[model samples]
Target: MQPTILITGATGGIGIALARLLKDHAQLVLLGRNPQKLTSLQTEFPEARTEALPLTDAQAVQALIETLPALDAVVHCAGEVVLSSIQDSQLEDWESMYQSNVLTALVLTQQALPQLRASRGKVVFVNSGAGLRASPGWGGYAASKFALKALADALRQEEPLISVTTVYPGRTATDMQKQVRDMEHAEYQPEKYVRAEDVAQAIKTVLDMQRPSVIEELSIRPG
Candidate 1:
């Protein structure tokens, strides 16, 4: 049987690219926050399941997982980014960053652990390059990503049955990247960055890897 994969942030650039690539290969369970986008995805991937779930809501995520009989993979593509310096950043800024970038991944993964262990599934976190280092104006965002990396690392150690991989992609040409450029007061050049499809292809590689050798981490950058 084809693997049953759950992809969060299914409406985002990388998520959409990945879903398009895997539509014929796997049973997709696309989860996103925007109801309208989820509707569009339902039309787009008629055979795939779609859910408009708030991943941060532990109760909601648990309730959703209760419906799934088998899940082979869970790819976390949902996240947010905000550029702020130490002096200008507000407390809520950090809180929101953690909530979106870190908590959602944690809550969803925690709720789905039982099935993952049963299926010996894969967990992929679509992390950012900022996760490895903190730029001047990117401290808050980086901190949250760093925390996400920590979560992935601990999961890798704790859940030996399930392979955990963190993918760090450099600036990609997406709407989010455009917003990031606008924040930096720079030009929005989609052509200069990595394509979302490339990232998706790399993720497919991770999910397809066979036994005895798991991809613990992967880093991708623009050419």
Candidate 2:
């Protein structure tokens, strides 16, 4: 049987790229918020199951977890980014980023732990370079990503059998990166940024890693 992998943020650039890359060979459960986009993608990847909902709701996540009979991996790419100096950052933006970046992963992973343990699965967190270091206007988004790193680190130590990998991709050419560029008043040059498919390919490498070893963390910057 093909390995079953559940990927969040399925409608996003990197998410869609990864789905296309894996759909032919893997069983995919793609979770995202945009119903129309999810429906559209379902048509393209007819074999993949699509779920449309907010990941912040623990109850909804719990229900989803119960429906999965078997799962081999989970790739968390669902997250939000906000740009602001420490002095100008809004309380709500910080909270929203935390909920989107950290809490969603927590709820989804917590509910799926049983299946993960049973399968000795892999957990991949799609983090950002901001997670490693903060810039002047990146405090809020950076903090949330940093918290996500902490979550990945703890999961690794606690679930030794289940491989946990955190992938930090630098400024991928996604809509989110365009938004960041707009906020920064810089020209949005998609060619100047890393390619989304490259990030997706890197993730495929992580999942292909075998027993007796695991990729703990990977960081990619534009070449």
Q: What is the C-alpha lDDT profile of model 1 across 1-223, one tens digit per residue? A: 9999999999978999999999999999999989999999999999999999888899999998889889999999998888988999998989998999999999999999999999999999999999998899999999999999999999999999999999999999888899899999999988999999999999999999997689999999998
Highest lDDT against the true fold, candidate: 1
Candidates in order, TM-scores: namely: 0.98, 0.98
lDDT of 1 at 93: 83
lDDT of 2 by residue, 106-223 (tens): 9899988999999999999999999999989999999999999999999999998799999999999998999999999999999988999999999999999998689999999998
Cα-based lDDT for every prediction: 0.95, 0.93
* Clash-forming residue pairs, model 2: none
Candidate 2: lDDT of 76? Answer: 96
Report how far off residue 36 is in candidate 1 (Å).
1.3
